[model samples]
Target: MQTNVYNIAFAESTKQVYLHFWGCNIKCKGCVCQKVVYDFMLDRNMHLHLAEPRGLAAAPERFMAFNDVIDTLVGLEAKWVLFEGQEASLDPQMPFIAEALHRHLGTTNVLLTNAFVMPDLRHFDKVAVGLKAFNENLHREYTGESNRTILENFPRIFHSGVPMMAETVLIPGYIDYQEIEQIAKFIASVDKNIRYQIDAYFKAGNNPWRRPTADEVDRAVEAASKHLNNVYAYKGSEPREFGVKSIFPTEAELDAAELAPAVESRHLVYA
Candidate 1:
């Protein structure tokens, strides 16, 4: 099966496989994919110092083969396979891939998506929705898409019997603590025990928003905690406990990779 998977990384300590798909449904102003596509945890300092966006430096020429993907996962002995980067939900083969890996390797399949287009939750063990903003106008202004479907799908997926979590980037001026509290309240309404994570947005391209300070992230988490029972903060700049090694396209291949023209057409544009 041909797949949009471009980059894959394995973290020995965590026993997790990071499966990165190429295209996205909505274009966010400060999308981390535009800055760095590979595991930022591999070299946090270099990624942190990047002033300009690298665009699609990690884009692959074509989709990967299903057999190759399965073989690689089997070899790595991955306990968890996280479908992320750009948007894994955009790939039509995601459900099949998740099912295949679970059946053949028994790897816990997790998907990190923007929740604009809901995937078949039956195949996934857990789904983490990247809820950008609770306010419709702000969400559209930031991501160039409406949050209507995303908000509707959140509860729909959660009620599907699949484990679910919600996360949002804490863009200081654009999506601050106030916005986070609203998102948390929404999630709490569905189920307050659901895990909610607030990630500190990093600078990307010419986006006017600045990165939130550690203290600012803490305040956002505090606000979210008021509504949700489980809330956490993630500062991407911080060092990770374990190092991740590139599994599919090695560091050399990623360095020499170029975005295919056809791939741009795959990016979903909201009508």
Candidate 2:
């Protein structure tokens, strides 16, 4: 089977592997992918400031094979696998990958999705949904897609028996604290105990929005706390407790890499 996974990073101290998929159904205006290609934690320097868009970072020409993916995970001795990047749920082989990881390596599987497409949840140990905005118009304006399905999917995924959490980015002028409260209330309606995380929006692309101040993030968290029992805020640039290394398309390979330009291919999903 084919997989959308293009990049992989491993944290040795944490025994966790991050699987970055290549495509997204909805395009967000301030997507971090437009700036940095890999997770910040995986960066050797762990730069606090967002790097300018460097195009596709070491991405392969084609999607990886199922056996190749499994072998790499097994070699990493991964205890956990996080399916992230543009969108994990968009990958048709996600369920199979999660199941194989659990069955063969006994690894915990976590999915970080935009909540645009709901995938089979039975194989996943945890799910983190990105709740962009609660207001329909605002959500559509920011993500370039209607959030009706995302709104509907959140509740369904919560009731699916797998542990779940919700998160949103705090764009200073746009998706502010008031908007966060609406999202929190919506999640609370399903279950007040569901964990909600507020993230500071880092500057990316030519987007006019700026990163929220620590005070702004705190206010958004405070607002969200009113409806949800568990609310936390993240600056998105926290220092990593462990070291991370690129597993797939290693630094050497990427140095010699001759792939398509990021503008033309970063968002493309090969089947």
Candidate 3:
């Protein structure tokens, strides 16, 4: 049970986990995955490509034997393992990694994939696919390709009996009601039970998308509400921003007192 070294997704509030593998097919234009790009550039001994592929560099650095990885998970007593990545299904070793982790953690396994590769769910406990931008052309424009595979794999995996969810980057103008509706339709086709999430893309540091507005987010959520039973908007601050307390709840605790429920405030605009 060998495992590949990867950056753990250290969300301020979430479950204990590790991003198992590396490399991605999509070089999203405004990617938050810049670390992988930098790592790939360093690993391949290549320079930065801020061009079409944007920050997508390939550095397939693997580490930690499978057994060792399992031992570590057991040692940490991590009840759950999340196989996360730009598109984890693209990693061939995913099934093996999942199997090994399943045996040890016996925890719910969640995969965050763009669905670049059709996954073999024989080992997965839960799967989350990025529906990305709602608009087909818009999605391709940002992520470098159309989400045909992700779209195609929807019902296939849903019917496979794994707990699944569909998510999107709520980029207004990029992801409008039409787009959200399309995403909802796709998820409903798979399983009406699958949850949906809209991650608000705000400017991070000096990153270009740092200040995406809340109106657009509202539109996306409004649209998705028609189709998805559950939806959460990421990046919007709780209480202060008037967002749901459980909007982006911590993995360990569903109800953390610090993150109070929002009061439904005004949509924020980026400067």
Candidate 4:
């Protein structure tokens, strides 16, 4: 089966390579990736603003073949491979990708997902479920999709007996300390010892939420630690100064590169 891979990059902080696939089911209001991907596909000038709703009709460049991606990861001596996406589970060959990363490269495969659809957990070495918000109303508001399926899939993932971790972006008022605490409590229900990483939300696109201050991150972690045993928070940049490469253009590259020529049609667009 063919995989619709759009980009591949390595994260120095985790020493893991990321395989960026093309689609996502949920459209989070504050998503940074949507802006970046749309800019790469539509706005040739590489403006940081959102593409015209219609301009999203342009097809993304298929940067590399699946096997090429595998070969690249192996050459990098990558021990860990992350399946990232607008939603990785949406990829038809997702399980195959995880299996390939493990069977062919001996890499620890981790899927970073919203967990709306629970796949065979046995295919992965680790799973990081992004619990956007525990409150259903807030969840729907933030992600533009109901959290029912996601919440239901949580136990299924936990019971699969695969190693699991939870992550939630700490958007000051919307996804605040109380929200993290509530999310931590829910995770603690499944496993008190599961590591809960409360990440400070970064300002992306036109998101109105402010980036969390160091003290805010500390408070959120402290509050979450009340229920979760392994509570951690990351407030600063990942050691991105260490060289990391991507098949797609970064913000800087987009600004420097000439705008792409107009296209007549596209098979898909960000709906």
Candidate 5:
């Protein structure tokens, strides 16, 4: 089977590679991925433009056989692989894909999802679920979906023995400190040991929300820590620095990279 994987990169923290699958079931209002993915799609050469200056490297969007993906990861010496982007569970063959990664390469798999449609997490080593809000109405307003299924799936995944973590964007006044406190309390009620990370929401594209101040972020983390044993916050605007190498000589070279034709195509899955 072939998948519309548009991007791939390595994460230093996890010492793993990520394959960004194309599709998401929810429309989160302030998602920055829209700018990242579409910018590249509009000008297949854009990733190269950004990659060169930042010393970041990535491959163009393409379709690859499942076995080919496993081989590539093996070549990269990838021990962990994160399946994300728009909601990886939307891929019908995800379970099979996860199994293949493990069976062939002994690579551990992790999934980043909205948790709307629960998947069999038996093969996954970890799962990070984005909880938009603890209040149902706010969740529906922000993500255009109810939080019922997402919240229910959290405990299920945690109880399944696969590690689980919950993350929410600190969207300034919108999903602010009050909301995080409630979210932390809710997670604590289920299992205090579950990891929680508050991601900083930064202005991107036409998103109106402003990024939280360092002081605000610190307070949010402190509040969440009260309810859970392990709590962290990701200040996206200030990502931990890392070194990367280019696989292509230039934008033209990147744009010229060979891409296998997709046997099946899906619609744009996210904003």
Candidate 6:
């Protein structure tokens, strides 16, 4: 009776395989994968919601059994099966899911999450905690929830003795120079077992906002440099990697047209 919510991915960039869980604890507003969980609003036009899995389509089934999910991975015969995406800890399913995949495939499990909910430490090998922002207001404004939950849970999340990769997405104007400085110092104050990741934002996905200037991203990076070690920006996404897809007509695209973005139009159709 394990949850059948996670997926196996083969990344073209790194030739790496990933096992990501669906659903999330915090709703980083305008998120792309709207079909996956309840934290954010869904955009049906851009992303589809199917009743079952068929190829790369997003499946509607929220829970995936570990044994059956493992069968998918072993069949693919991938090198490293990373436990990634959405938020892996929304249910007790992850620890058991991780255990099943690791025991059978003997592949590495890497988690990329907001750290709002920490999994049992004994489950995985490596962890990547999306350390959203150092300040509470900015974090909530950007991701739609206070940083308090994450701040409280992060310490115990690392009890696994596994190295953690700390990530921070630098959105335009949201994460200012002062905030970046605070973020760096905060990361440094926490156990130094973490690596700092500064990622950039774009008009795509579920992200809705103005694009920050290149200079601003640079300044934030500079401010962060003073407080911690090993900082790097998440390279911007390609304009439209066809297979990469879009959730809604991007904000810029929405403004450019006199018409409604697909989300509104589609809702009108079925309403």
Task: Please give the CA lDDT of all the candidate structures.
Answer: 0.80, 0.82, 0.58, 0.73, 0.71, 0.58
Go through the candidates in order and give the C-alpha RMSD of each one to the true structure.
Answer: 4.7, 3.7, 11.7, 5.3, 6.6, 8.5
Q: Write the per-residue lDDT of candidate 6 for residues 1-271, one digit (tens) a residue.
A: 6764533445433435555566677767534454232211112232322122121213334446666676766665645656665777675777776777677777677777778766675666777787777778877876888998787767666655777877776666666567767877877777643677776654433433545566777777778787777776654432323222111223344234324344422321111
Tens-digit lDDT track of model 3 for 157-270: 787888888777665555555777788877876666688888765432223443346776777777777877787676444332111111111222322321444334511111
After superposition, the stretches of candidate 4 with alpha carbons farther than 4 Å from their true spots are 11-15, 38-59, 237-241, 247-271
Using TM-score as the yardstick, the better of models 3 and 6 is: 6
Per-residue C-alpha lDDT of model 2 across residues 1-271, encoded as one tens digit per residue: 7888888888888899999998899988888666556555565525635544433333346568888999999988899999998988888888899999999999999999888888888889999999999899999999999999999999899888899999999999899999999999999999999999998887676677778888899899989999999999898656557788877768565444434244544442110
lDDT of 5 by residue, 71-170 (tens): 6766677788888877778877778778877887788898988889888786899999888899999999988999999889888888888888999889
Deviation in angstroms for 258 in model 1? 11
Top TM-score model: 2
Instruction: Choose 2 or 6, whichever is better by TM-score.
Output: 2
User: What is the C-alpha local distance difference test score of candidate 3?
Assistant: 0.58
- Ordered by TM-score, highest first, the candidates read 2, 1, 4, 5, 6, 3
Q: Rate residue 227 of model 1 by lDDT.
A: 92
Candidate 6 error regions (>4 Å): 2-7, 12-15, 34-63, 204-208, 237-271
Write the candidate numbers in order of decreasing lDDT: 2, 1, 4, 5, 3, 6
Model 6 reaches what TM-score against the true structure? 0.71
Q: For this target, which candidate reaches the highest lDDT against the unseen true structure?
A: 2
Evaluate model 1: give its TM-score. 0.89
The per-candidate count of clashes, in order, stands at 0, 0, 8, 0, 0, 8
Q: Which residue segments of model 3 deviate by more than 4 Å?
A: 1-3, 9-15, 35-62, 204-210, 239-271
Worst 10 residues of 3 by lDDT: 241-250
Clashing pairs in 6: 3-64, 4-63, 4-64, 4-65, 5-64, 19-82, 30-206, 199-234
Indicate the worst ten consecutive residues by lDDT in candidate 2: 262-271
Error of 1 at 163 (Å): 1.1
